[model samples]
Target: MGRHRNDPRGIAQMVAIGGVIVLFITLVILGGFFLYKSLPSGSDTAAVPEGAAGTTADPQAEEMPTGSLYIRAVGESSEVVVTVPGGDVLADTTLKTDEYLSFTEERTLSVTIGRPSEVEIYVHGERQDVEGEDPGYSFAVQP
Candidate 1:
């Protein structure tokens, strides 16, 4: 039958084709694995707790902002004289601890001067002062 028609050549061609197919399959599998790893991890979700979804917790989730202020007299029992803008005393009673004397509609704050020294007033964590006028030794707080 014409010397078996070069059977070795056909076997070699089949082996080459099989090698190429195996290489293509390996490349596809590797590409899929890399894509899965590049996707967002469980820590990226906002509603889920960190470290419980087989991933570390989000660093931002642990931080929170608590908006509040605490004011205290700079000295031991100084005369905290408080006033409104128009030379109006905040209240008839002297401002002390556990008292709410310096508030205006929950926005504007009345400042308290403890004595006749230069006093510094603050509102919302910012300085509120009069130009060229001494605030006296009273302390003020923002509401």
Candidate 2:
């Protein structure tokens, strides 16, 4: 009763080591699901203010708004919210570390955002008067 010698090359090397451990766990779960969907998924929600300035009391002596809202920062922090509608002004602007914030306007704007930041609201004074449209402010950012 000694019939034990059926090694088909050790079951084809244990099925090629279980198909290389299931192709390395399916490429590490599709590379962690595309690195969690390329990160930066904070879902951006507020940022809109670029030109048309007149919150009174001097911001370079007001009166210059044909569109200009520029905030720059590659990394470290950013929060912006600028809303201006016939006077109930709002400004929560912040761009830290590599800092930069600018505005000039003629009234008419809207912005909502979050995370993965890099903004440049255009139409800036190419000799002014692109025919009015700027004045909207409320910004936010810290650290």
Candidate 3:
């Protein structure tokens, strides 16, 4: 056999080509990682316009409501059950005289009162009339 035919040069050349391919792949992956880190995030993309009415740059400003419901037990002790319309009950407990509760809901609420005269209801700081509703009455209120 000739020396050139039996030489190990071909194996060395194959290994060098494989090393170059691996190095090129590693560089491409690292470049993609650095590019991703330099880009702006999704939260920073939207900028609030200037001089817009009722527009706030704060992220929490969009979560608040314009009004809420306020309930108080005034004349005497009473048991109250507050439920969402056709849904689960939010509160089912007793309230003593001068005790107060508040909530914020966008839909109508079904309020069951053990003593209508003892419980007082308010919406957005305005007192609501509960004169005609008798004791053990359940009524619906919206906010």
**Candidate 2 residue lDDT tens string, 34-60:** 999988666432233344243222223
Worst 10 residues of 2 by lDDT: 126-135
Best by TM-score: 3
Which candidate number maximizes lDDT?
3
**1-143, model 3: which lDDT tens digit per residue?**
55574469977887899999999999999999999998867452222233322222232233322345555666757787777767666676676655555566677777788887887776655777875788888777677
TM-scores of the candidates in the order shown: 0.30, 0.29, 0.48
Minimum summed lDDT over a 10-residue window in model 1 is located at 48-57
Better of 2 and 3 by lDDT: 3
Per-model C-alpha RMSD: 21.2, 13.0, 15.1
Backbone steric clashes in candidate 3, count: 0
Cα deviation at 64, candidate 1, in Å, is: 11
Q: After superposition, how far is residue 65 of candidate 1 from its true place, in Å?
A: 13
Flag regions of model 1 displaced more than 4 Å.
1-6, 45-143
